[model samples]
Target: MDNYLTKTSETERPEFKIPDFIENMGPEQIHERMMASLPEDIDKMPGGFPFDYTMPTAAIASELVHYHLVRGLMAAFPEYAWGDWLDLHAKQAHLSRKPANKAAGSLTFIGKPGTVIPKGSMFCTAATAAGSSIDFLTDEEVVIEEEGRATAAITAFEAGKKGNVSQGTIVLAVRPISGLTSVTNLEAVTGGAEEETDDALYRRIQMEHSMQSFSYIGNDNDYIRWAKEVPGVGDCIVMPAWNGPGTVKLVLVDQNGEPANEKIIQDVYSHIVSEEDRSKRLLPTACSQLTVTAAAGLSISYICTGLIYDKDTTTLEQAAAEFERAVQQVYSEARESGTLIYNKVRSLITDLPGIVDFETFLINGEEKNIVLSKEEYPVTETVSFR
Candidate 1:
């Protein structure tokens, strides 16, 4: 608990140390305690007959001391626990590790006419450096037109962070071939997500209670809470009666507040509608129509100005970066679509050090509140400081 910011345990104490008196304790000390509680002449036919190796009591005491030492040590750290504690937590919340997903995008192959590029043709981002290039395989065999460009679907050889590349990033071929010279990625290769991390698992375990389903009133909070139970659903909104009676609309964003991909949307939709899906712990009431979709994305461009102090190590650039990060973290926590209060942003600026006066604070070029619809969340685009 000392270093709470990152849950660090640098100066933690060792739990398994033997007590000083017990570690140095000898047979003589054990005999003394026994003698004090016993009769003076209970068994004194021979020399030290009551407290000898023949009695076996000394050996029993040693065993008990060892038990205490081992138990204390095990209590010191979570790793010492026989099983993975976090794994247990994940099981309770049904939070399983998601496998790495390959980012899917379009690949363009430009070559001579009628060139038959076989299916599973290899291409990468670079020529010489194989690792530097993100490899892709043609999804289907495409025959090129006469001296024209043909696009193919290239699946990454392996799935991981390597495939989460930017748009137009992978342009080079892994090895050159006749009639296949240039290659380009037409769109961003998104949907590539790494395996679920321990931190992510632990966070969800902490929310098991809040995410528990109620008696299926199917109200706004019920829909939102249950919708987020699906993996990769970062945040969600519930619009009750959006399409008149017995209809509800749900909008979801990915864990990073981006639009949910096709796969994610389908997963959410199945969980909400189907009775046999993994997350369909309890099906919704009959006769209620449900619509699951991705929320509209919007960015909040703002300018923050503050006075500079002479001794401050932080520059305006650094402060602006910090302010922008704050907006993303704070605003996304709730993500309730509606009016974004201008005063909340101004209050955030007031707390920053050396900002004696907030000269100009604007959200999307407005000094006052900026209202957003039910399907929008604020994106952290730019934060400028003067």
Candidate 2:
């Protein structure tokens, strides 16, 4: 597995600053406007709300807007139009936070199997920034209850902290853009009418999920092709962990406000279970990243027969080995079929023997495989044919 790494330096790159929640404003004034976004109760409540719950910093607010904005961009504009933005922004914006003394951002990515990342590609992380302070009110008790009625009113201040950041970066330098699809489209399918048999409904659901997954990938490819023509953009890259691609980090230089304060966006990956677990055959995992959830996608492993029947009475270990080999061969072919494929890379066999030799199979000729086996093989004892 030969691999190379690429890093975008701030010195060489142009200004990619995430503009302050408000451009060219002093903190005092910006603070005043930010207070307006707060709930009215803070004014009424003696002890105001906490910062996290009450006031959102300019950077924090901007992040909310930026993520939705990008999503809107991806949704509203054609892939070509969206690509134009991505390409232009990658150069003009920071891939990560600005370097020391340098007012620009950069990012690094490790190229993986079958792909080589190119230079000047744009990758971006989108999400809310963390660690902002909100003007809140807190109650201070005074000894004189009635005489003083003295409740020392304190500004209920809540400090901003990063929540589980789930935003993934788009790296357009490793693989062609066509390879990456926003899984946001593969939504769950509704179950069929009551009259439909379980088999028919299950089949329909599986097929729909597969089709939607394929469609997402198809759209992503289109997105990449469109991005290629944009100025200042380079080739796109797709990563294994499917938050889209690349290793870019988006940081909030300052919260949106007149005098925006510096705050960081909490990392989102920790909260999301990576698609890596979706590949296991026995362990059923949901594809949260995929827009669709009702059924397994193209490279899914589905249950067929719950019993492992080896007429020769082969040992479970032997049967399992052979089954695994067969499945591996199938996966190789599935990868070449040019269809959307989803496989969970991380899975553990936990369930006990439910159905003997019940084997799992990959649907739609996808590049996924499974195996089953029995515990014993019988020797020929001149048995009579039935």
**How many residue pairs clash in all the candidates, one count each?**
4, 58
What's the C-alpha lDDT at position 87 in model 2? 35
Residue-wise lDDT of candidate 2 within 210-313, one digit each (tens)? 44422323233322222222221112221223455322211111211001111111111221223354342211133223221111122233333344444565
Give the TM-score comparing model 1 with the true structure, all chains together.
0.60
- How accurate locally, in lDDT, is each candidate? 0.63, 0.27
The TM-score of candidate 2 is: 0.14
lDDT of 2: 0.27
Q: Which portions of model 2 show Cα errors greater than 4 Å? A: 1-13, 18-21, 24-53, 56-60, 65-386
Per-residue C-alpha lDDT of model 1 across residues 1-386, encoded as one tens digit per residue: 11111221211222333456566344445655666666776763336766563336755675565555544454333323222554664565665545555655677778887877778877777634555557887778888877588877666777755776767778876667688767788776655566555544444444554657244666666666566666666677778788987788888776555666555676777876775754654446753688888778787788865555434656677667656645544555436647667887777665554555557788888888766678887666677888
Which candidate's TM-score is highest?
1
In candidate 1, stretches whose alpha carbon ends up further than 4 angstroms from where it belongs are 1-87, 96-105, 108-166, 175-182, 191-207, 211-218, 244-246, 271-290, 307-321, 350-358
